[model samples]
Target: MKPGILVISHGSREAAWVKLVDDAVIAAAASPCLSDIPIVSSFLEIIEGRLIQDGIDELERQGVTDMYVVPFFISSGSTHVDEIGQAFGLPWLTDLEGDLGTFRVSANVRYGLPIDDDPEIAELLAANIAELSTEPEKEALLLIGHGSKEKMFHERWQEGLLKLGERLRALGGYKRAEYAMLLPDQAAAKLAEMQAANPGEAVIVVPLFLSRGYFTNHVIPTRLTGLEYRYNGKAMLPNQAIERWLERQMLEGLQRLNEK
Candidate 1:
């Protein structure tokens, strides 16, 4: 069976954001670990023409009979991941109503998961906040994510973020690592709570977004107004580790395809 890889991510209107994903995909494709299969990056929405359907059609045109759809999202708890999987004939597991309909597909799909608690992700984040953190023992990391109001989705975010926080703490030897969601607007409250709970520790605010966009640039900073904290606003993009993670996922998919 002819197989290909498709990385699906939440699209942003920011050119830099889109370019980061594309650059990672290109780097992943260039890896020697992967076979010479057609691979592309597609978005769930926002970007015109490069939508999920367009990606499917492009790969199908290349005579790809099987595909692995990898969720490039930060967390699998994202509702978009569930809906997009549903569009590819997976079960609609979420309680939220999805506006995305089924797409035309003739090839067999091998759905891949998101970057929840990958060690590479932990390393990437630790590296990202290395500059902001002076003393790991006296610092606390507060990861901010775009949380959901829905129970199931919110839980998913919590599960992933919690595990990720543990990993970061273990890797960086930080005093504490916690997360806050933007949807429920918990950034400010969480920071204050953390500060009160762990006095004398410097709080480092890290945004759990794929790229440095409006959320990382403006929303996060605005939410934490008047709060004393360290922030670099560096996102999970333009990192070699992420490129390796992408390649590793696609490589594992290739192995799975071969096993079948």
Candidate 2:
């Protein structure tokens, strides 16, 4: 009845995107502390043979009686996260404003939180922008993400990013920190406003995506066509910090179970 770690992500057809997640898991699994554990990285969709259920089945096949599901998403506001919970026969949503409630699974399930405004994540953002910054004190930081149009869902993005923005500004010493969303088509306008508000200050665009896929590869560039800004198109992946984040979550879940 040993525990296994199942990392769930929003899948993509892009081989590169899938590889990023796989590499992160591989790196984590290589760690001395986790080398003995059964760690499988799976996706929600778009991969050929790997899906959430496939991951669950794999863990069960490995003789895992307790599975820790680490949802590798940008925000808990994602509808996909809720759907994944329901797919496992867990309560869909007892409280939308708070953490997505735990669910009942074939195996004892321990769910982990999404990467929402964690200080480590904020450090990643600052690092991405720092590469393009000449004078952070004169530049504006614009953090963009796949935001929701729905009222409550959008609020989640706003609140999370606002905290992240504050953290990024503090860490990077930027003149100001701001946020833009793609859902309501506010990214373009927001970028323009940031520039207008601080004339001559460079704007560094940081994408808050889990991987460098379609949106980061194409859509974001397409959307920012007319604007002159600095961006490296880096997504959160292949970072050891993420593996540490997953480990910390798994330990917390394990501790709760031990207490009970």
Candidate 3:
């Protein structure tokens, strides 16, 4: 029986955005190492059809003896990732062994490892910044993320941004690289502040989100216009390194399951 691979993500209401993630995952699965694996994707919330259990059921039907679930989130500190794992009855302390009555299916699930952690991710961000900014000297890189009310997750995002900024600074090409949160303060206001700090310099607002949705498509563009700032906007979609990261996590999960 072929081992099943499930790419799990926080589902979005926006169809186009969801399709973009799906397409990215499909492309990732097409990697030479994972091309033959029976890979499927499902959402933890918001979207329909293949919820976590639905994906599990299909995999079982296909006679899959083992499964690997990789969460497509930017932060490993998210509460949703923990809650989703709990919903599947796999607590943080327990091993990945699922009892399905007639056919026992062993499973392993891993949560977020921020894109910024990947070495290639910094290059991707820099490329995006270069594409958006015509004047490297006058332009500033603004990384915008959805902050959490909870301090833990919020701090995680902040730290991730700082690390990424450091990497960019080490590259030493951009005028400045800074980060801001959408939850704590309005993105528009933040952008305005950034523009004011560096007059005549363009800002490239990169949504530090895994997938584009309400924030990337509507809120960001609207806010840029409202703030009366010259800006460039783009969704932080997955790149080649992200796929390798996912695969590595899957392999690690499989190793843990084998040990058990």
- Top of the candidates by TM-score: 1
Provide TM-scores for the models: 0.96, 0.90, 0.78
Tell me model 3's lDDT, rounded to 2 decimals. 0.65
Return the TM-score for candidate 2, rounded to 2 decimals.
Answer: 0.90
TM-score of decoy 3:
0.78
RMSD of each: 1.2, 3.2, 4.9
Tell me how candidate 2 scores on lDDT.
0.80
What 10-residue stretch in candidate 2 is worst by lDDT? Answer: 95-104
Name every residue pair that clashes in candidate 2: none
- Model 1 Cα displacement at 184 (Å)? 1.3
lDDT of 3 at 70: 78
Tens-digit per-residue lDDT, 14-35, candidate 2: 8888888888777767767666
